[model samples]
Target: MQVHEIQVRSILTRTGGFLREGYSHTLNPYRGCAYGGALCGLPCYAQHSVWITSGRAWGSFLDVKVNAAEVYRSQVNRERRWAATRGGLRIYMSSVTDPYVPQERQYGITRSLLEVMLDEPPERLVLQTHTPYPLWDLERLRALLPLVPDLSVNISIETDRDNLGPGFPPHATPVAERITALESLRKAGIPCVAVVAPMLPIEDPREFARRLGAACDRVVLDHFLLGDGSPGGLRTRRTGFPSKLEEAGWQQWTSLEQFEKVCDIFSEVLGADRVQKSRHGFNTPGPGRCSETTTR
Candidate 1:
Protein backbone atom coordinates (compact mmCIF):
# COMPACT_ATOMS: atom_id res chain seq x y z
CA MET A 1 0.00 0.00 0.00
CA GLN A 2 1.13 3.56 -0.66
CA VAL A 3 1.65 5.85 2.31
CA HIS A 4 0.55 9.52 2.14
CA GLU A 5 1.36 12.12 4.71
CA ILE A 6 1.70 15.86 5.53
CA GLN A 7 2.73 18.20 8.36
CA VAL A 8 0.76 21.13 9.74
CA ARG A 9 0.54 23.64 12.57
CA SER A 10 -2.77 23.44 14.44
CA ILE A 11 -5.72 21.52 12.97
CA LEU A 12 -8.44 24.19 13.14
CA THR A 13 -8.61 27.94 12.67
CA ARG A 14 -11.07 30.43 14.21
CA THR A 15 -11.44 33.08 11.55
CA GLY A 16 -14.23 35.43 10.44
CA GLY A 17 -16.08 36.90 13.38
CA PHE A 18 -19.85 37.17 13.88
CA LEU A 19 -20.40 34.84 10.91
CA ARG A 20 -18.04 32.37 12.59
CA GLU A 21 -20.00 32.79 15.78
CA GLY A 22 -20.70 29.72 17.98
CA TYR A 23 -18.89 27.21 15.78
CA SER A 24 -15.43 28.65 16.15
CA HIS A 25 -13.54 25.57 17.29
CA THR A 26 -13.01 23.04 14.49
CA LEU A 27 -11.74 19.52 13.81
CA ASN A 28 -10.43 17.66 10.72
CA PRO A 29 -10.18 13.87 10.60
CA TYR A 30 -7.39 13.87 8.08
CA ARG A 31 -4.47 16.25 7.88
CA GLY A 32 -5.07 16.69 4.14
CA CYS A 33 -8.29 16.26 2.17
CA ALA A 34 -9.05 13.54 -0.39
CA TYR A 35 -11.65 15.31 -2.50
CA GLY A 36 -9.14 18.12 -2.93
CA GLY A 37 -11.27 21.21 -3.52
CA ALA A 38 -9.87 24.59 -4.48
CA LEU A 39 -11.48 26.47 -1.60
CA CYS A 40 -10.46 23.93 1.00
CA GLY A 41 -8.02 25.17 3.64
CA LEU A 42 -5.67 22.19 3.81
CA PRO A 43 -2.36 23.75 2.81
CA CYS A 44 -0.79 20.37 2.07
CA TYR A 45 -3.17 18.92 -0.54
CA ALA A 46 -1.99 19.73 -4.06
CA GLN A 47 -5.28 19.29 -5.94
CA HIS A 48 -7.13 22.10 -4.12
CA SER A 49 -6.97 23.18 -0.53
CA VAL A 50 -4.01 25.52 -0.08
CA TRP A 51 -1.54 24.06 -2.56
CA ILE A 52 -2.82 25.73 -5.71
CA THR A 53 -3.12 29.16 -4.15
CA SER A 54 0.64 29.67 -3.91
CA GLY A 55 2.17 26.20 -4.46
CA ARG A 56 2.72 26.30 -0.70
CA ALA A 57 0.31 23.40 -0.32
CA TRP A 58 1.84 20.10 -1.41
CA GLY A 59 -0.15 18.04 -3.96
CA SER A 60 -2.24 14.91 -3.38
CA PHE A 61 -0.61 14.10 -0.06
CA LEU A 62 -2.23 12.67 3.08
CA ASP A 63 -1.40 13.55 6.63
CA VAL A 64 -3.69 11.46 8.73
CA LYS A 65 -4.14 13.44 11.96
CA VAL A 66 -3.87 10.20 13.92
CA ASN A 67 -5.37 11.47 17.18
CA ALA A 68 -7.79 13.85 15.49
CA ALA A 69 -11.02 12.92 17.24
CA GLU A 70 -9.42 11.90 20.49
CA VAL A 71 -7.66 15.23 20.56
CA TYR A 72 -10.89 17.10 19.97
CA ARG A 73 -12.77 14.99 22.46
CA SER A 74 -10.20 15.67 25.17
CA GLN A 75 -10.07 19.38 24.45
CA VAL A 76 -13.82 19.85 24.16
CA ASN A 77 -14.36 17.88 27.32
CA ARG A 78 -11.97 20.17 29.12
CA GLU A 79 -13.71 23.27 27.77
CA ARG A 80 -17.15 21.90 28.63
CA ARG A 81 -16.71 22.94 32.26
CA TRP A 82 -16.09 26.57 31.42
CA ALA A 83 -18.61 26.49 28.56
CA ALA A 84 -21.33 25.25 30.89
CA THR A 85 -20.60 27.91 33.47
CA ARG A 86 -20.17 30.79 31.06
CA GLY A 87 -22.58 30.39 28.18
CA GLY A 88 -22.61 27.78 25.32
CA LEU A 89 -20.29 25.59 23.34
CA ARG A 90 -20.21 25.37 19.57
CA ILE A 91 -17.66 23.37 17.59
CA TYR A 92 -17.43 23.50 13.83
CA MET A 93 -16.56 20.16 12.27
CA SER A 94 -13.92 19.92 9.56
CA SER A 95 -12.83 23.51 9.18
CA VAL A 96 -9.47 22.48 7.68
CA THR A 97 -10.16 18.84 6.79
CA ASP A 98 -13.46 17.25 5.81
CA PRO A 99 -14.92 15.28 8.71
CA TYR A 100 -16.56 12.79 6.30
CA VAL A 101 -14.13 12.10 3.46
CA PRO A 102 -13.64 8.51 2.18
CA GLN A 103 -10.99 7.69 4.80
CA GLU A 104 -13.73 8.36 7.37
CA ARG A 105 -15.41 5.15 6.20
CA GLN A 106 -12.70 3.39 8.17
CA TYR A 107 -11.67 5.83 10.92
CA GLY A 108 -15.14 7.09 11.85
CA ILE A 109 -13.84 10.08 13.83
CA THR A 110 -16.65 12.34 12.67
CA ARG A 111 -19.09 9.72 13.86
CA SER A 112 -17.24 9.52 17.13
CA LEU A 113 -17.47 13.28 17.58
CA LEU A 114 -21.17 13.08 16.88
CA GLU A 115 -21.39 10.43 19.55
CA VAL A 116 -19.50 12.65 21.99
CA MET A 117 -21.83 15.52 21.27
CA LEU A 118 -24.67 13.20 22.07
CA ASP A 119 -23.12 12.24 25.38
CA GLU A 120 -21.83 15.68 26.43
CA PRO A 121 -24.30 17.83 24.53
CA PRO A 122 -22.79 20.95 23.07
CA GLU A 123 -25.05 24.00 22.52
CA ARG A 124 -24.27 23.72 18.82
CA LEU A 125 -22.42 21.46 16.44
CA VAL A 126 -22.14 22.97 12.99
CA LEU A 127 -21.21 20.29 10.47
CA GLN A 128 -19.87 21.41 7.12
CA THR A 129 -18.73 19.30 4.20
CA HIS A 130 -18.46 19.67 0.44
CA THR A 131 -19.55 16.08 -0.06
CA PRO A 132 -23.23 15.61 -0.79
CA TYR A 133 -23.29 11.97 0.29
CA PRO A 134 -25.20 11.94 3.55
CA LEU A 135 -23.65 9.58 6.07
CA TRP A 136 -26.63 9.48 8.35
CA ASP A 137 -25.55 8.86 11.92
CA LEU A 138 -29.17 9.06 12.97
CA GLU A 139 -28.68 7.95 16.54
CA ARG A 140 -26.43 10.94 17.05
CA LEU A 141 -28.42 13.58 15.14
CA ARG A 142 -31.56 12.37 16.84
CA ALA A 143 -30.03 12.31 20.30
CA LEU A 144 -28.73 15.86 20.14
CA LEU A 145 -31.70 17.16 18.20
CA PRO A 146 -33.08 18.88 21.27
CA LEU A 147 -29.96 20.14 23.01
CA VAL A 148 -27.66 20.88 20.11
CA PRO A 149 -30.68 22.03 18.16
CA ASP A 150 -28.56 24.61 16.44
CA LEU A 151 -26.87 21.97 14.30
CA SER A 152 -26.45 23.33 10.77
CA VAL A 153 -25.15 21.60 7.72
CA ASN A 154 -23.37 23.42 4.93
CA ILE A 155 -23.08 21.03 1.97
CA SER A 156 -20.88 22.81 -0.52
CA ILE A 157 -21.08 22.41 -4.26
CA GLU A 158 -20.18 24.53 -7.28
CA THR A 159 -22.22 22.94 -10.06
CA ASP A 160 -24.84 20.21 -10.11
CA ARG A 161 -23.28 18.34 -13.02
CA ASP A 162 -22.29 14.70 -12.84
CA ASN A 163 -19.41 15.16 -15.27
CA LEU A 164 -18.44 18.68 -14.24
CA GLY A 165 -17.36 17.16 -10.90
CA PRO A 166 -14.39 18.46 -8.95
CA GLY A 167 -11.00 18.13 -10.57
CA PHE A 168 -9.36 17.06 -7.32
CA PRO A 169 -8.05 13.63 -6.28
CA PRO A 170 -9.82 10.28 -5.75
CA HIS A 171 -13.44 10.95 -4.81
CA ALA A 172 -16.16 8.70 -6.23
CA THR A 173 -19.46 10.47 -5.54
CA PRO A 174 -20.41 13.04 -8.18
CA VAL A 175 -22.34 16.28 -7.77
CA ALA A 176 -25.67 14.67 -8.64
CA GLU A 177 -24.96 11.88 -6.19
CA ARG A 178 -24.18 14.37 -3.43
CA ILE A 179 -27.38 16.26 -4.21
CA THR A 180 -29.30 13.04 -3.65
CA ALA A 181 -27.49 12.36 -0.41
CA LEU A 182 -28.24 15.84 0.90
CA GLU A 183 -31.86 15.39 -0.07
CA SER A 184 -31.92 12.14 1.86
CA LEU A 185 -30.66 13.97 4.94
CA ARG A 186 -33.49 16.49 4.61
CA LYS A 187 -36.00 13.68 4.19
CA ALA A 188 -34.69 12.14 7.38
CA GLY A 189 -35.64 15.43 9.07
CA ILE A 190 -32.18 16.93 9.38
CA PRO A 191 -31.93 20.69 8.75
CA CYS A 192 -29.52 21.02 5.83
CA VAL A 193 -28.26 24.18 4.12
CA ALA A 194 -26.78 23.87 0.65
CA VAL A 195 -23.93 26.31 -0.01
CA VAL A 196 -23.29 26.98 -3.71
CA ALA A 197 -20.24 28.97 -2.85
CA PRO A 198 -17.38 29.98 -5.08
CA MET A 199 -20.29 30.08 -7.47
CA LEU A 200 -18.63 29.35 -10.75
CA PRO A 201 -20.18 31.31 -13.58
CA ILE A 202 -21.91 28.27 -15.09
CA GLU A 203 -25.31 26.55 -15.44
CA ASP A 204 -27.61 29.55 -15.16
CA PRO A 205 -27.14 30.61 -11.54
CA ARG A 206 -30.81 31.41 -11.19
CA GLU A 207 -31.90 27.99 -12.35
CA PHE A 208 -29.30 26.36 -10.15
CA ALA A 209 -30.66 28.15 -7.08
CA ARG A 210 -34.23 27.14 -7.94
CA ARG A 211 -33.32 23.48 -8.37
CA LEU A 212 -31.14 23.42 -5.24
CA GLY A 213 -33.81 25.15 -3.14
CA ALA A 214 -36.24 22.47 -4.26
CA ALA A 215 -33.91 19.84 -2.77
CA CYS A 216 -32.64 21.62 0.35
CA ASP A 217 -34.27 23.54 3.16
CA ARG A 218 -32.05 26.58 2.45
CA VAL A 219 -29.45 27.75 -0.06
CA VAL A 220 -26.37 30.02 0.33
CA LEU A 221 -24.36 31.34 -2.59
CA ASP A 222 -20.86 32.90 -2.75
CA HIS A 223 -18.61 34.04 -5.57
CA PHE A 224 -15.57 31.82 -6.35
CA LEU A 225 -13.56 33.62 -9.00
CA LEU A 226 -12.38 36.54 -6.90
CA GLY A 227 -9.25 36.80 -9.06
CA ASP A 228 -7.47 33.65 -7.92
CA GLY A 229 -6.35 31.53 -10.91
CA SER A 230 -5.07 28.16 -9.79
CA PRO A 231 -5.16 24.44 -10.75
CA GLY A 232 -6.52 22.73 -7.65
CA GLY A 233 -10.31 22.16 -7.52
CA LEU A 234 -10.61 19.31 -10.03
CA ARG A 235 -10.68 16.20 -7.83
CA THR A 236 -14.40 15.50 -7.57
CA ARG A 237 -15.50 18.09 -10.22
CA ARG A 238 -14.19 20.31 -12.99
CA THR A 239 -12.27 23.57 -13.07
CA GLY A 240 -13.33 25.38 -16.27
CA PHE A 241 -16.82 25.77 -14.77
CA PRO A 242 -15.76 29.28 -13.71
CA SER A 243 -14.91 30.27 -17.28
CA LYS A 244 -18.58 30.76 -17.99
CA LEU A 245 -18.58 33.65 -15.50
CA GLU A 246 -15.57 35.19 -17.22
CA GLU A 247 -17.06 34.80 -20.70
CA ALA A 248 -20.60 36.06 -20.13
CA GLY A 249 -19.31 39.47 -18.94
CA TRP A 250 -22.19 40.32 -16.65
CA GLN A 251 -24.11 43.59 -16.89
CA GLN A 252 -22.63 46.97 -15.92
CA TRP A 253 -21.20 46.76 -12.41
CA THR A 254 -17.67 47.95 -11.74
CA SER A 255 -17.40 49.40 -8.24
CA LEU A 256 -17.86 47.40 -5.01
CA GLU A 257 -21.50 48.38 -5.13
CA GLN A 258 -21.81 46.30 -8.32
CA PHE A 259 -21.87 43.14 -6.19
CA GLU A 260 -24.89 44.35 -4.26
CA LYS A 261 -26.44 45.31 -7.60
CA VAL A 262 -25.85 41.74 -8.79
CA CYS A 263 -27.46 40.39 -5.64
CA ASP A 264 -30.47 42.62 -6.29
CA ILE A 265 -30.54 41.31 -9.83
CA PHE A 266 -30.32 37.75 -8.55
CA SER A 267 -33.24 38.43 -6.22
CA GLU A 268 -35.21 39.79 -9.15
CA VAL A 269 -34.38 36.98 -11.58
CA LEU A 270 -34.52 34.06 -9.14
CA GLY A 271 -37.64 35.35 -7.40
CA ALA A 272 -37.87 36.02 -3.66
CA ASP A 273 -40.49 33.29 -3.31
CA ARG A 274 -38.34 30.55 -4.87
CA VAL A 275 -34.91 31.99 -4.11
CA GLN A 276 -34.30 34.19 -1.06
CA LYS A 277 -31.88 36.97 -1.90
CA SER A 278 -30.04 38.80 0.89
CA ARG A 279 -26.95 40.91 0.55
CA HIS A 280 -25.19 37.62 1.41
CA GLY A 281 -26.42 35.49 -1.53
CA PHE A 282 -29.12 32.96 -2.57
CA ASN A 283 -31.17 31.04 -0.02
CA THR A 284 -34.34 28.94 0.31
CA PRO A 285 -37.10 31.11 -1.08
CA GLY A 286 -39.10 31.49 2.11
CA PRO A 287 -40.87 34.04 4.27
CA GLY A 288 -38.48 33.66 7.20
CA ARG A 289 -35.23 35.52 7.79
CA CYS A 290 -32.92 33.21 5.80
CA SER A 291 -29.27 33.88 6.66
CA GLU A 292 -29.78 34.01 10.43
CA THR A 293 -31.04 30.40 10.65
CA THR A 294 -28.72 29.01 7.97
CA THR A 295 -25.12 30.29 7.82
CA ARG A 296 -22.62 29.20 10.52
Candidate 2:
Protein backbone atom coordinates (compact mmCIF):
# COMPACT_ATOMS: atom_id res chain seq x y z
CA MET A 1 0.00 0.00 0.00
CA GLN A 2 1.32 3.39 -0.99
CA VAL A 3 1.32 6.06 1.74
CA HIS A 4 -0.13 9.44 0.81
CA GLU A 5 1.80 12.52 1.96
CA ILE A 6 -0.76 15.27 2.43
CA GLN A 7 0.49 18.72 3.47
CA VAL A 8 -1.41 20.23 6.42
CA ARG A 9 1.00 22.76 7.90
CA SER A 10 -1.75 24.09 10.16
CA ILE A 11 -3.35 20.89 11.55
CA LEU A 12 -5.33 21.94 14.62
CA THR A 13 -6.96 25.26 13.70
CA ARG A 14 -10.43 24.79 15.18
CA THR A 15 -10.09 21.48 17.07
CA GLY A 16 -10.15 23.27 20.42
CA GLY A 17 -13.89 23.92 19.91
CA PHE A 18 -14.62 20.29 20.84
CA LEU A 19 -12.75 18.54 23.68
CA ARG A 20 -9.08 18.58 24.66
CA GLU A 21 -9.22 22.31 24.00
CA GLY A 22 -5.95 22.65 25.87
CA TYR A 23 -4.50 21.02 22.74
CA SER A 24 -4.66 23.83 20.21
CA HIS A 25 -3.08 21.75 17.41
CA THR A 26 -2.92 18.10 16.32
CA LEU A 27 -0.43 15.97 14.25
CA ASN A 28 -1.77 12.52 13.38
CA PRO A 29 0.82 10.64 11.29
CA TYR A 30 -1.91 8.14 10.53
CA ARG A 31 -5.44 9.01 9.48
CA GLY A 32 -7.46 6.16 11.13
CA CYS A 33 -6.87 4.47 14.51
CA ALA A 34 -5.89 0.91 15.50
CA TYR A 35 -7.18 0.89 19.10
CA GLY A 36 -10.78 0.50 17.80
CA GLY A 37 -12.12 1.59 21.19
CA ALA A 38 -15.86 1.69 21.93
CA LEU A 39 -15.87 5.36 22.98
CA CYS A 40 -13.44 6.20 20.20
CA GLY A 41 -16.53 6.97 18.14
CA LEU A 42 -17.49 9.93 20.37
CA PRO A 43 -14.38 12.25 20.83
CA CYS A 44 -14.02 12.01 17.04
CA TYR A 45 -17.16 14.11 16.54
CA ALA A 46 -15.33 17.24 15.34
CA GLN A 47 -13.28 15.34 12.78
CA HIS A 48 -16.13 13.09 11.70
CA SER A 49 -18.16 16.09 10.56
CA VAL A 50 -15.56 16.77 7.84
CA TRP A 51 -13.98 13.38 6.96
CA ILE A 52 -16.70 10.80 7.64
CA THR A 53 -19.44 10.63 5.02
CA SER A 54 -21.91 7.86 5.90
CA GLY A 55 -22.06 9.10 9.50
CA ARG A 56 -22.81 5.65 10.96
CA ALA A 57 -19.46 5.87 12.83
CA TRP A 58 -15.80 6.60 12.21
CA GLY A 59 -14.04 3.76 10.40
CA SER A 60 -10.68 2.32 11.55
CA PHE A 61 -8.34 2.59 8.62
CA LEU A 62 -4.73 3.85 8.96
CA ASP A 63 -4.20 6.26 6.03
CA VAL A 64 -0.73 7.57 6.83
CA LYS A 65 -1.15 11.36 6.78
CA VAL A 66 2.36 11.43 5.31
CA ASN A 67 3.02 15.14 4.72
CA ALA A 68 1.80 15.86 8.28
CA ALA A 69 5.15 16.92 9.71
CA GLU A 70 6.19 19.38 7.01
CA VAL A 71 2.86 21.17 7.31
CA TYR A 72 3.15 20.94 11.09
CA ARG A 73 6.50 22.77 10.97
CA SER A 74 4.97 25.52 8.89
CA GLN A 75 1.99 25.71 11.25
CA VAL A 76 4.30 25.82 14.26
CA ASN A 77 6.19 28.68 12.68
CA ARG A 78 2.95 30.52 12.03
CA GLU A 79 1.64 29.63 15.50
CA ARG A 80 4.90 30.82 17.02
CA ARG A 81 4.53 34.09 15.14
CA TRP A 82 0.91 34.27 16.35
CA ALA A 83 2.09 33.41 19.88
CA ALA A 84 4.79 36.06 19.73
CA THR A 85 2.18 38.54 18.56
CA ARG A 86 -0.78 37.29 20.63
CA GLY A 87 1.03 35.02 23.16
CA GLY A 88 0.13 31.29 23.67
CA LEU A 89 1.26 27.82 22.60
CA ARG A 90 -1.30 26.68 20.03
CA ILE A 91 -1.50 23.00 18.94
CA TYR A 92 -2.35 19.43 20.03
CA MET A 93 -0.98 16.13 18.66
CA SER A 94 -4.33 14.35 18.33
CA SER A 95 -8.06 14.92 18.74
CA VAL A 96 -9.46 12.09 16.61
CA THR A 97 -6.75 9.39 16.40
CA ASP A 98 -3.96 8.13 18.63
CA PRO A 99 -0.68 9.83 17.70
CA TYR A 100 1.31 6.69 18.55
CA VAL A 101 -0.88 4.00 17.04
CA PRO A 102 0.58 0.82 15.49
CA GLN A 103 1.21 2.61 12.17
CA GLU A 104 3.60 5.01 13.96
CA ARG A 105 5.97 2.13 14.71
CA GLN A 106 6.76 1.69 11.01
CA TYR A 107 6.49 5.18 9.44
CA GLY A 108 7.78 6.90 12.57
CA ILE A 109 5.66 10.04 12.01
CA THR A 110 5.64 10.83 15.71
CA ARG A 111 9.42 10.39 15.88
CA SER A 112 9.91 12.86 13.05
CA LEU A 113 7.43 15.30 14.60
CA LEU A 114 9.41 15.21 17.86
CA GLU A 115 12.59 16.17 16.03
CA VAL A 116 10.95 19.22 14.51
CA MET A 117 9.56 20.37 17.87
CA LEU A 118 13.00 19.86 19.48
CA ASP A 119 14.82 21.82 16.79
CA GLU A 120 12.89 24.90 17.88
CA PRO A 121 13.01 26.69 21.24
CA PRO A 122 9.93 24.78 22.63
CA GLU A 123 6.26 25.41 23.30
CA ARG A 124 3.18 23.93 24.96
CA LEU A 125 2.79 20.36 23.63
CA VAL A 126 0.00 18.01 24.80
CA LEU A 127 -0.01 14.29 23.80
CA GLN A 128 -2.89 11.78 24.21
CA THR A 129 -2.42 8.04 23.77
CA HIS A 130 -4.16 4.72 24.54
CA THR A 131 -0.87 2.83 24.53
CA PRO A 132 1.74 3.86 27.13
CA TYR A 133 4.78 1.77 26.06
CA PRO A 134 6.30 4.39 23.72
CA LEU A 135 9.99 3.63 24.21
CA TRP A 136 10.44 2.75 20.51
CA ASP A 137 12.64 5.87 20.29
CA LEU A 138 13.75 6.74 23.79
CA GLU A 139 16.66 9.02 22.84
CA ARG A 140 14.36 11.29 20.85
CA LEU A 141 11.63 11.61 23.52
CA ARG A 142 14.36 12.20 26.15
CA ALA A 143 16.03 14.90 24.07
CA LEU A 144 12.76 16.60 23.13
CA LEU A 145 11.46 16.46 26.72
CA PRO A 146 13.95 19.12 27.87
CA LEU A 147 13.32 21.46 24.94
CA VAL A 148 9.51 21.07 24.91
CA PRO A 149 9.35 21.33 28.67
CA ASP A 150 5.66 22.24 28.73
CA LEU A 151 4.75 18.85 27.29
CA SER A 152 1.95 16.89 28.94
CA VAL A 153 1.55 13.17 27.99
CA ASN A 154 -2.05 12.09 28.62
CA ILE A 155 -2.10 8.24 28.78
CA SER A 156 -5.67 6.97 28.25
CA ILE A 157 -6.69 4.05 30.52
CA GLU A 158 -10.46 4.12 30.93
CA THR A 159 -11.07 1.12 33.16
CA ASP A 160 -9.49 -1.74 35.09
CA ARG A 161 -10.93 -4.36 32.64
CA ASP A 162 -8.87 -3.43 29.56
CA ASN A 163 -8.05 -7.07 28.82
CA LEU A 164 -10.68 -7.10 25.99
CA GLY A 165 -12.30 -10.53 25.97
CA PRO A 166 -15.99 -10.89 26.76
CA GLY A 167 -17.42 -8.15 24.55
CA PHE A 168 -14.13 -6.46 23.70
CA PRO A 169 -11.91 -7.88 20.97
CA PRO A 170 -8.44 -9.32 21.49
CA HIS A 171 -6.54 -6.47 19.84
CA ALA A 172 -6.76 -4.16 22.86
CA THR A 173 -4.65 -5.13 25.85
CA PRO A 174 -5.95 -5.18 29.41
CA VAL A 175 -5.90 -1.92 31.35
CA ALA A 176 -3.82 -3.54 34.09
CA GLU A 177 -1.15 -4.41 31.54
CA ARG A 178 -0.79 -0.82 30.43
CA ILE A 179 -0.72 0.72 33.92
CA THR A 180 2.94 -0.21 34.26
CA ALA A 181 3.61 1.51 30.96
CA LEU A 182 2.88 4.78 32.76
CA GLU A 183 5.30 3.78 35.51
CA SER A 184 7.95 3.19 32.86
CA LEU A 185 7.25 6.61 31.34
CA ARG A 186 7.49 8.43 34.70
CA LYS A 187 10.73 6.56 35.40
CA ALA A 188 11.98 7.79 32.03
CA GLY A 189 11.35 11.32 33.32
CA ILE A 190 8.83 11.87 30.55
CA PRO A 191 6.21 13.30 32.99
CA CYS A 192 3.15 11.11 32.30
CA VAL A 193 -0.41 11.94 33.48
CA ALA A 194 -2.85 9.00 33.60
CA VAL A 195 -6.20 9.63 31.85
CA VAL A 196 -8.75 7.59 33.87
CA ALA A 197 -11.26 8.05 31.16
CA PRO A 198 -14.51 6.59 29.78
CA MET A 199 -14.68 5.00 33.19
CA LEU A 200 -15.61 1.32 32.75
CA PRO A 201 -17.81 -1.04 34.78
CA ILE A 202 -15.25 -2.71 37.03
CA GLU A 203 -15.38 -4.91 40.12
CA ASP A 204 -14.13 -2.07 42.27
CA PRO A 205 -13.88 1.62 41.29
CA ARG A 206 -12.07 2.96 44.35
CA GLU A 207 -9.19 0.49 44.13
CA PHE A 208 -8.88 1.14 40.41
CA ALA A 209 -8.28 4.85 41.04
CA ARG A 210 -5.79 4.12 43.83
CA ARG A 211 -3.73 1.79 41.63
CA LEU A 212 -3.60 3.91 38.44
CA GLY A 213 -3.03 7.08 40.46
CA ALA A 214 0.04 5.53 42.04
CA ALA A 215 1.73 5.02 38.66
CA CYS A 216 1.44 8.30 36.73
CA ASP A 217 2.72 11.75 37.76
CA ARG A 218 -0.91 12.99 37.88
CA VAL A 219 -4.42 11.65 37.09
CA VAL A 220 -7.17 13.06 34.83
CA LEU A 221 -10.70 11.63 35.31
CA ASP A 222 -13.13 11.08 32.38
CA HIS A 223 -16.41 9.19 32.25
CA PHE A 224 -16.86 6.20 29.87
CA LEU A 225 -20.59 6.55 29.27
CA LEU A 226 -20.91 8.98 26.34
CA GLY A 227 -24.65 9.61 27.21
CA ASP A 228 -25.63 9.30 23.55
CA GLY A 229 -28.07 6.45 24.45
CA SER A 230 -26.73 4.34 21.63
CA PRO A 231 -26.86 0.55 21.68
CA GLY A 232 -23.81 -1.75 21.90
CA GLY A 233 -22.23 0.79 24.28
CA LEU A 234 -18.63 0.36 25.50
CA ARG A 235 -17.96 -2.99 27.17
CA THR A 236 -15.14 -5.13 28.64
CA ARG A 237 -14.03 -8.79 28.85
CA ARG A 238 -13.22 -9.21 32.53
CA THR A 239 -16.43 -7.59 33.77
CA GLY A 240 -18.54 -7.89 30.59
CA PHE A 241 -19.50 -4.18 30.89
CA PRO A 242 -18.24 -0.59 30.58
CA SER A 243 -15.94 0.86 33.26
CA LYS A 244 -17.05 3.84 35.36
CA LEU A 245 -15.02 3.05 38.43
CA GLU A 246 -13.72 6.63 38.71
CA GLU A 247 -16.89 8.58 37.95
CA ALA A 248 -18.64 10.86 40.51
CA GLY A 249 -21.63 8.83 41.76
CA TRP A 250 -20.77 5.30 40.56
CA GLN A 251 -20.87 2.80 43.41
CA GLN A 252 -20.99 5.78 45.80
CA TRP A 253 -17.25 5.39 46.40
CA THR A 254 -16.47 9.08 46.27
CA SER A 255 -18.48 10.78 49.02
CA LEU A 256 -20.94 13.47 47.87
CA GLU A 257 -20.09 15.85 50.73
CA GLN A 258 -17.13 17.17 48.75
CA PHE A 259 -14.83 16.29 45.87
CA GLU A 260 -12.12 15.86 48.48
CA LYS A 261 -13.66 12.49 49.33
CA VAL A 262 -12.54 11.24 45.92
CA CYS A 263 -9.35 13.29 45.71
CA ASP A 264 -8.23 12.16 49.13
CA ILE A 265 -8.26 8.46 48.17
CA PHE A 266 -5.41 8.70 45.67
CA SER A 267 -3.98 11.80 47.35
CA GLU A 268 -3.50 9.88 50.56
CA VAL A 269 -2.25 6.82 48.70
CA LEU A 270 -0.36 8.35 45.79
CA GLY A 271 0.50 11.50 47.77
CA ALA A 272 -1.50 14.60 48.73
CA ASP A 273 0.58 16.47 46.19
CA ARG A 274 0.25 13.98 43.29
CA VAL A 275 -3.31 12.58 43.49
CA GLN A 276 -5.79 14.75 41.45
CA LYS A 277 -9.54 14.90 40.67
CA SER A 278 -11.93 16.96 38.50
CA ARG A 279 -14.37 18.40 41.12
CA HIS A 280 -11.49 19.37 43.45
CA GLY A 281 -10.11 21.90 40.93
CA PHE A 282 -6.86 21.51 42.90
CA ASN A 283 -6.03 18.09 41.37
CA THR A 284 -5.35 17.13 37.77
CA PRO A 285 -8.30 15.88 35.63
CA GLY A 286 -7.39 12.20 35.26
CA PRO A 287 -6.99 10.77 31.76
CA GLY A 288 -10.69 11.44 30.88
CA ARG A 289 -12.90 14.47 31.78
CA CYS A 290 -16.57 13.57 31.16
CA SER A 291 -17.87 15.68 34.00
CA GLU A 292 -19.19 18.83 32.32
CA THR A 293 -19.21 20.68 35.65
CA THR A 294 -15.50 21.43 36.05
CA THR A 295 -14.11 20.61 32.59
CA ARG A 296 -16.68 22.59 30.57
As a whole number from 0 to 100, the lDDT of residue 85 in candidate 2 is 40
Model 2: per-residue Cα lDDT over 1-296, one tens digit each: 22344545445453333333344445566665665444443333323444622343244445676676676676676666655543355455675567877668777788777777777634566667777546565577678666764666667775676443343444244466568877666666666677655444345557877777666666765332222113233222122232333332344322233233444565666665555443231122223311112210
Off by over 4 Å in 1: 1-19, 37-59, 81-87, 163-172, 225-296
- Candidate 2 overall lDDT versus native: 0.53
What tens-digit string does per-residue lDDT give for candidate 1 at 1-296? 12244333444444343234345455565655665533332222224444423443332445566554455556666666655654456666655556667766766667766776666666666677877644557557756667674666667765554433344333235667667766666665676666655443334555665566656666655443231222233332243333433344532221224434444555565555433322233212122223323432
Model 1's C-alpha root-mean-square deviation from the true structure amounts to: 7.1
Which window of ten consecutive residues has the lowest lDDT sum in model 2?
287-296
| TM-score of candidate 2 relative to the true fold | 0.71
Best by TM-score: 2
Candidates' C-alpha lDDT = 0.51, 0.53
